[model samples]
Target chain A: MARSPFNADEAREAWRRYVSTGAVARRLLRRSTYHAWARCHDLGASPHLLKAEALSVSDTERLLAEQREFIAAATPFMAALSRAASSDRHAAMLGDGRGVVLDVVGDEASVRGPEAVPGPGCLLAEETAGANGIGSPLAEQGYVEFVGPEHFIGGFHPFTCQGVPIHDPQGRTVGVISTSVRRPAASQRLRDILVCAANGIEAELLRLRLERDVERVLASGSGSSLAKLRDDVVQTYAAARVRLEAAARRGPAASEYTLALVREAQRTIERFRHRAALWRDLASDELGMRQPFRLDQRVVEIVDLLATDAATRRVALVASMLEEARVVADARAASREIFGAIVSALENAGEGGSVEIAIRLARRERRAVVSVSASPAPGVAPAGPLAAQLAYEAAP
Target chain B: MTRERSGPGPSSGRDAERTALQRRVLLVDDDDDFRASVAEVLRDEGWEVTTAHDGEEALALARALDEFVLLVDYRMPGLNGGEVFEQMRGRSPSRLPAVLMTASKHVADLAAHHGFRHHVGKPFSLDDLLGTLELALRGGEPGE
Candidate 1:
């Protein structure tokens, strides 16, 4: 038979001294252990007998469900600890923050014996079970061990146990891992193992939390980038409409072409507004929307408007148009807002300045491209409407 | 439409003298296109327009001119519009009612902080700019 290091009389004297003068017993007992002793005393527990409150089956199931992820993460550690203590009459147990025993593994006959050993659903909080190993570590948020007479209850004098508090990544004490044996073993080595196991569980919790955060950031980043693009497009379209309206009021020489162009531009503006609204709506939807709009006709009309307006400004307009301009392909739909922005950019370059505007529309296999280039007249200060206009178009 | 002057009637001899005194405007913008177009409009409306390509030139003009309302761009290569306005306030003997124009979303905040009489955002209609200018000249009354 293995004997305890301290006898019942010594433990009783130590407890009495702690109760009388708290600081006098600090050498033999940690402050946390003394606090647990005080709590057990205040809870109306008897020091000479073992009595524990237990949670009902439904409550136990709810607690297990709430801690499902934690329990899963700590399973391998629990198994390894149980195997390490197999040679001794020891049982490994996991307890929640409230001290309810959630899991157990060991040689049943040896660990359980004739006494009703604490198992799943057993409430072992210090307030209910007195100053025992499992509940003390939970209360202290650190490692704890008690052998024989060190247990407050006389009935628990036959058993010895070691426990360590498990923490989450944020350093919050989440639960306790404990091992109980009928006879006391070398406690320091057992305490070291429990601490290492708790650390492994906390590391796993940190990794899981990091992965979840990364997933959320990636999901929100794509939507926000697209929203920014949509906002820029709407602003550019508004600027284009203002420029076109200003160009139309410039007088009678190019009235016919300007009138037709303005009407077409108005219709295109309306369509662009409608599409922008739709894009906003789709972005707000739970299921992501990836719809594209056809903009070939609008692109052609905008090009014509740019050409006519440039000619009226007397800035030398030059254009090369495609016969069947495939401005937007079925697979990749281009925005009318882009074309409007380009037209606005060209008109601003030609307005009130002797800047020559060049526009080109070319058709490739699956894409239609439009490019606008401008060259200001010499002796005109380089700081002109074109620079300001280009700056606005290029702004994110 | 012939808009009525807000302060005093142009027919009054005293009001005519005041109008002549405040007829000059200092237009400062880096962009030549905006300067030429806006100067043409202001001149057509019977105000003498003096132009400057940047802030330094505008400050030099302000020192030389007797009395003028200032129209300045907010963002410039050297000495931004707000800095120029501050420098002008320091140099000018009289309170200069001015209009600050910008293409930024912070125009209202900038205008309030700098105590500008009025502000207009870019891509603004010609009418809007004229209206804001008229209001600033009229001691900032609510425009009709």
Candidate 2:
């Protein structure tokens, strides 16, 4: 049998009892709402608090500007969700992870009155607003529905609200989507719509992030790098297939080993994906022979890209660098040599080994010096016309 | 619960309908031969398969349909598997479990990063493919 709908009258009576006697009627409230109310009481929040805090006019405008991408990603979804809810007494809102309202749509009257509509810049974090839809989700980093009397503060008792936190690609809550209805008995349909909209908004945010990375690649002037990255992705699979076929030819004994080989190839591609942008940087250097760029940034980027590979090999790659260390040379030659030197060093270090990359400015020599050193060090010493670049020095 | 191919035919209309609904899936890949072959296998296994050649095409189908799992290739031109999965997830109103198909070595990490519970490596056996898909349908993690 389906569970009965939420009872606001029973919740109201329970809330009064809890506020006066510190006792909870668990059956009358959702566990999430009960916990949120407990947290509010622990923080010494007043049940009689009349309104939520609002930001100053300038602060509100600044917040609106700061959350531009978040609002832009969520606007269409919020509008659609609001339309689907299709109630004149319902309002949808978008709030930052900090519980500050960024955007609100639908019936403004739902949030109207002494508590404020939580339009732009209203700070509804649980400490201030007391277990509200917007603020509770941010605090708990999950979905929260505070229906009418479920709100710790009496001011919110006239409204039923549900909030769902939106997460970034890394799974951190970046913002929240919420719905508010004027009456206590909220429709379940509106809550479902809000949750779906939140998920969709997060997906859009990830797409936008990828777009920005693409723009960065174009801005870095590495069109060829995009092609190179694409080629790398294609070649990775082809190479894995070759390895598999070779292992198969070696007989049945190689089956287990072939799986390992495929696993390693998979890691290579994963690392490649992780450092796809860095590949673009390398491609940029592959252009313009006399172009002067910060050798420090280049070295740092290489280190960042190789860090995962190094971890897999059980070798630590550490770097010490001087800021703004510029080197004017065949940028491609400098980067290639530096990358080769580091790879050689990582190899020489062996398992449980360490390779240090240092970038220093030799003011007297008027050059930015880079050195890759390992315990045993690489076999071949630095011998190149790119002396203006750096040296592959051994650490004694 | 495993469904025996021998059980209830079209005569059992409700069971057939329920099974069909439960077995629906979207297969996205740029490789025509691979996609077609996999779709055939899945169809043979009693799955209702929808195929897309690219991310954009997959997104269009996803928007048009609902309540199906996604089996996507990690690499494809214009949007790739990761982007397509995310975009579809954003556009849909329900949880859509997915299984990744990739030739890359770090298949596990790639699948996890892209929010896929399971992955089938390239040059995989028929059993491996079906098993992974079943695991995803069950909402189980890779090992489980």
Candidate 3:
């Protein structure tokens, strides 16, 4: 075969420079050695990760196995976390603050990865380091780039990587898990995706720590005051569990390989306990919060509000609107509610959906800002601006 | 030039029949709906087609069948597309030239190692899928 015009090193370097301009990519270099090494490869900087780092091949292999084991344990929780991010393009990712990736899994390549890999496994160097989901989430943690010019590495450009750090029960960063390409998204959910995934890992740890007994106590307390108190605790626990599980499982498909999405959702919802306590404190100390409005007391009211048919429809409507405006159109609306929703969605996607929405004002659109984020949902087809651009004159 | 197989390989005076196997396919994807749709579309393009729901099933069917090439999806529930390719790679030289279906377009370098004719992505139209299929079918032979 004829050698290409540019040497491999130079080619990777140029692309690295280009990708570094992206919001998440530039910040990646700021992480610790382990994270930096992971980030380097996530950006397709394999040459540097392999050569510059003093870590031996054996270390890389060990690290890869560590990541694999971590992800395997967190799989169910991560899968649930990505479901939300996958559904709404406007959704943000849940992050544990390390790195965010979308649509690809990031991990050290195995020696055998150079040959051929089998079923749903992505090559991380030479050997298969990721089962589809982990690679994308790892990439989501640093930079969510799917096969395109925006991604620095041509080899992985076709695949999207969405990742985020997973946290242990006490919220310490443990490892990362992500989804890889089989799923694809158009833009801007990369960082957001990692955040969501990170949150998912945390939620999983918490669920494993606390959720199992929650259901039992609530059920046993079927009737009476003690039973009612137990029921209340269970309800709060269940809600928190739901959110935690969702955040973990609903991540990008690339990230959810061996896990189920519902598990993650339940995990996220389980955090209601902490939030509920915070609400109680706010009622007493904060001025805006109503007096005598104990969060535990308002649980019924809050549940009522959430359970209303209209509320459910509104959630869907909001999610769909986010998809149309932010996920598909790349337009950022300015309303506080819209902003909050978009931010939350981005956070959700970062948990593991392979979508990146990078927002800045559009090139020529007057007074309009484009969200600079990408959503990396595997198999989620990207929408085009062909029609939206044509409709711009009519976009009041 | 690569040597032709004695019997199962290309035959003498069978050069005219290149169009025959060239127009047939063995497609593998876990999604039955997707497989059916692909088969129908390929049939429309003057090709014969078969489908498999999982990687194991696809590999099992491939060994039993003759003449047709293959199209496999990288992400299935079990025995994914890559595993199927590895199995196919173990087969006799007379049978080869499988194309892969993956969303991992970034792994272009790795996918190239499978010795297949093409690696296409999912969510593609029948036209795009068939185009690559036709291209692979035209070059229905393996490389060293």
Q: Tell me, by TM-score, which candidate is best.
A: 2
Candidate 3 lDDT by residue in tens digits, B1-144: 011122232222344655545555777765443455455435534555677877777777777667777788765554656778888878847757778875332335546776555776432433455557656777733231
Model 1, position B133, has a per-residue lDDT of 70
Local lDDT at A318 for model 2: 89
Write the residue-wise lDDT of candidate 1 on A1-396 in tens digits.
222344546565665664455423434444555566667777766664565567898988998898899888677567645654566677788888889888877787644656646777887888778888778898777877776656666666677878888877567888889887778543444454555556545544543453354345347764433332333323333333333433323333444554443444344344444444444333332433233333434444444333323433445544444323423232222333334345444445544443322223333234334444554566444333452111111101
Q: How high a TM-score does candidate 3 get?
A: 0.29
DockQ for each model: 0.03, 0.05, 0.02
Error of 1 at B95 (Å): 95
What order do candidates take by TM-score, descending? 2, 1, 3
Task: Summing lDDT over every window of 10 consecutive residues in candidate 2 chain B, give the lowest-scoring window.
Answer: B1-10
Candidate 2 lDDT for residue B124 = 56
Give model 3's TM-score for chain A to 2 decimal places. Answer: 0.34
Residue-level error in angstroms, candidate 3, position A89? 20
- Give me candidate 1's TM-score against the actual structure: 0.37
RMSD of 1: 28.8
Better of 2 and 3 by TM-score: 2
- Report interface Cα RMSD per prediction: 15.1, 13.8, 19.7
- TM-score: the better of candidates 1 and 2: 2
Choose 1 or 2, whichever is better by DockQ. 2
Sorting all predicted structures by lDDT, with the top scorer first, yields 2, 1, 3
* Deviation (Å) of A55 in candidate 3: 9.9
